[model samples]
Target chain A: MPTFRVELFEGRTVEQKRQFVEAITKATCESLKVEPGSVDIILVDVKKEDWATGGRLWSDAG
Target chain B: MPTFRVELFEGRTVEQKRQFVEAITKATCESLKVEPGSVDIILVDVKKEDWATGGRLWSDAG
Candidate 1:
């Protein structure tokens, strides 16, 4: 099973998630040759304070 | 670099997360022979409604 962990900035509607998963499933199937049912995707919503780049948190930046 | 996606049932405290990541990082290093910094782990808190097993959602399970 191919598992995908997607990190987003949060505040996405359910409809957006539905479409996102559908597209992601298709892409994963095409590349990994895995069945739709076998692909597992977990979307993680990360706050700006929780994420950092180059030793600086996203919330700290403009 | 080994990227790990960990799914949990949520409600874990910050100390728990810190310890979890440390242990996971150590285990990964020992097994994969990679540096601690090379192992990237993204912890995903999965809601019962969002998770399913054997075609049944966890939230629906009695």
Candidate 2:
């Protein structure tokens, strides 16, 4: 079973999340040949202050 | 190129997360020989209702 953990910015609606999980489950089933129920996707929301790139926090960057 | 996605219960403090990332980064560097900056770890906090195992939701089981 291949579980997907997606990290992105917050402020998404429930409808968006429902569509996203459905699409991802379908794609995963098609490619991996696994059942939709077995595919687990966890979405993580990262704030600008919590994320960093190139040794600089995103909040600090312009 | 090794990114870690950890799914667990929420309610952890910033100090805990800071320590967690540091430890994970250190371990990854030692084992995979990847730099701290190269490793990214995304933590996913899963609600009991969202997680299911053995055809039963965690929230429903309890």
Write model 1 residue lDDT over A1-62, tens digit each, in one string.
87766788877755566667778778877887877788766667779999999999999998
Docking class of 2: incorrect
- Cα lDDT tens digits for candidate 1, B1-62: 99998889888999999999999999999988989989999987787545443333445568
Model 1's chain A TM-score stands at: 0.85
- A42, model 1: CA deviation in Å? 0.7
DockQ of 1: 0.12
- Worst-scoring 10-residue span by lDDT in model 1 chain B: B49-58
Error of 2 at B16 (Å): 1.5
TM-score of chain A of each: 0.85, 0.82
Q: What TM-score, to 2 decimal places, does chain A of model 2 have?
A: 0.82
lDDT of 1 at B57: 40
Off by over 4 Å in 2: A1-6, A11-44, A48-62
In the range A1-62, model 2's lDDT, one tens digit per residue, is 88888888777999999999999999999988998889999987786545544333345557
Fnat of the models, one by one?
Answer: 0.02, 0.05
